[model samples]
Target chain A: MIDIELAFENLPPWAALLTAFCVFMGAFLTLTGSVGLLRLKTFYERVHAPTLGSTLGTGFILVGSMICFSVLRGRLSVHEILIAVFLTITTPVGFMLLVRSALYRDRVEGNDNVPEGNPTPGKQSAPDAAVQQD
Target chain B: MSASFLPADWPFVVLDWSLFIAQLFLGLAMACAAYRLILGPRAQDRVLGLDTFYVNAMLLLLTYGIRVASTIYFEVALIIGLLGFTGTVALSKFLMRGEVIE
Candidate 1:
């Protein structure tokens, strides 16, 4: 096994404590989100569960990583910030698409829980036209 | 290498303990996500589970990087995040329109 003590040798006590706290919080949030995903009854409700991990869980972990690297290197290593910004930008878009897609499929199948009407109005015609051509 | 701010004894121990615990939590989270992926009644649930799995895996990598004190892992984590988002988007598109591309 790799020696972990060597890794911590350069980290200050305050920085180490802060990093530990953030990492622990991130891990706890991720676990909770996963459990929520497993336990939620409906697709709509379950869809929200993973956001905890993608957003705040990711945030905490990235912050911890930033701190660890910055302190260890004795200078700001901000590259990890790129991951945080990219994730924050992309996750919501993906979730929106997935949730809308799920809703559309359910609505097309005649599910009553979802609001009536096609979710994508403009694009619906293109698909129908494709079917006609075939 | 930079000098440690703490006197080295207790803080290092605490950091080590926390790292181990964080790994344990992340592992359990991945298990939960996999369970959802396997047991999901619908495709959407499976996709969501897969997404969760991806996020958890990324976080796990971050923690592992911290443990090993390597910057390379950050690049790997970033790539995973990008690719996972694209995959999820494509899958969602397929589910909605019956095709990934028109």
Candidate 2:
């Protein structure tokens, strides 16, 4: 087996501590989000769970990665910033589409748990609203 | 090699061990997401679980990149991130409109 300690032997204490703290915190947040996703009672509640990971959990990991590579290369390794930016911008948009889709689906099913709103643009909602949509 | 090291590197052995612990947490997080993906009661729930899975997998790969000190892994993680977003977006659009392109 490869020696983990030896491989990481030269990492500076300060960078090591910083990377470890950020990684641990990110991983902890990710795990918490996963638990929430699994244990939440409703689809809407569960939908809110993974954003914890997709946002700051991912942000922390990317920051830790940027620091690690910069320290390793002794220069700015800002490629991670691309991932962070892309993720930050895209995650919310994807989740919004997903939650809106879920809401539409729930409303179509007439699940009664949905908040008040017309299922379609200008008509009374019904269980068959899905089939009757323009 | 610009790896600045303190005079005593042995005292910080916790670094590698802590990285290993973080990896374990990420793995467990992945398992939880997979559980939801495979067993979710509704279609949207499954899609949400898939969304969680891809994001966690991307971050996990990023941690591995740090562990191995390889920029290639970071590249792969980026690709995963991009693909995950596109895929989740497409899936949600399909769920909403009954077709991705329409």
Candidate 3:
């Protein structure tokens, strides 16, 4: 039953253990990232959390899967690289856009703590402005 | 049902146990991401949560692929990866520019 059946049956003990280690480590890293996402206090801080899973966590899992399939089929299976490349390429772009957008929004609404960005209208010129609004 | 899935020997036994562990962790991680998605204070935080959710889900599928010993799962994972990127990019673009296309 080629793919539908249990293919790991053909894998050797060494490769099986290696694959297991890789997959477990990846899952653990991903869990750590999720924990970080939940525990971080600020938005910017939270933004940093998911990257752990996306980068190294995904990397490890893909590697493990590659090894598992390669050993199973008796060939070098590396198509999982498509997912990896997409992850590496798109994660930073999306995050950069999201963070920049978030920053723009915060600045537009006059967050004085954020460094000035072309002074777009609502500058919150002084702490008095922030206080007076309250 | 369970017996059919179990391997006949030891090395594969280690793998089965590890796959179980990996699945458990990934599921919990997905829950954490979902929690953030539902409860985040801001729209950006929600988007961030959504991003993490899809990535975790993709990896989950990959592990499932290895567990089932199917390359078909790779296609599913690839689709998720592609969709995840497109969705996040569009949402973030909308967030940043206020209009997705303009």
Candidate 4:
């Protein structure tokens, strides 16, 4: 096993403190998000839970990582930024697709909990209503 | 060593304690997500649980990398993030269209 003391002996006090703070916050947020996911009743509510992790949870952790590595190597290590960017860009898209698909399936199954027809204005037509009816 | 910038021992102590606590929280998060995945009443709930599990796992990996002072795990964590998102997208697509491909 790698010795923790030996590995981090060179870590400055400020950097160590920052890393600890970031990691702690990140982990706490993730845990809260997961707990929310488990406790929420509906799939739509649950869909909102993981966003906590994908957003702030991921942001804090990646920032902590960047700080730790940059301080340890005595050089800027910003590669973890890639993860933050990728997650920020993709998470909403994924969630949007998932929620839309779930709504579509629910509507197709005639689940009354979800609103039927185009709730949007300027797009109401008999053919669309007919398609939904059939 | 840039330890000259902050010559103090308290931060290291704080770091050790916080790292342990963070790991504990992350583990609990993973357990919660697994519970949802296993006990979900609906398929979408299971998929949502799985997505949460992946994100938690990736965060856990980042903590592990910090603990070990290794950057290799960063790449692994990145891959997990990318692949996890892709898997969820595919799963959602399959659910929506009844198939992944047209």
Stronger candidate by DockQ (2 vs 3): 3
- Over 4 Å off, model 4: A115-134, B1-8
Q: Choose 2 or 3, whichever is better by TM-score.
A: 2
Chain A TM-score of candidate 4 vs. true chain A: 0.85
Give one digit per residue, the lDDT tens place, for model 4 in A49-113.
87998899989989998999898999999899899999999889888878877876776565656
Deviation (Å) of B52 in candidate 3 = 0.2
- If candidate 2 were superposed on the true structure by all CA atoms, what would the RMSD be? 4.9
lDDT score, candidate 1: 0.87
Once fitted onto the true fold, the runs of candidate 3 whose alpha carbons sit more than 4 angstroms away are A1-6, A112-134, B1-8
C-alpha displacement of B64 in model 4, angstroms? Answer: 0.5
- Model 1 CA lDDT for position B72: 78
Docking class of 2: medium
Which pairs clash in model 1? none
Q: How accurately is candidate 4 docked according to DockQ?
A: 0.72
Q: After superposition, how far is residue B38 of candidate 3 from its true place, in Å?
A: 0.8
Q: Candidate 1 at residue B83, lDDT? A: 96
Q: How many residue pairs clash (N, CA or C atoms closer than 3 angstroms) in each of the candidate models, in the order given? A: 0, 0, 0, 0
Residue-level lDDT for B87 in candidate 4: 90
- Most DockQ-accurate candidate: 4
Error of 3 at B25 (Å): 0.4
DockQ, candidate 3, vs. native dimer? 0.64
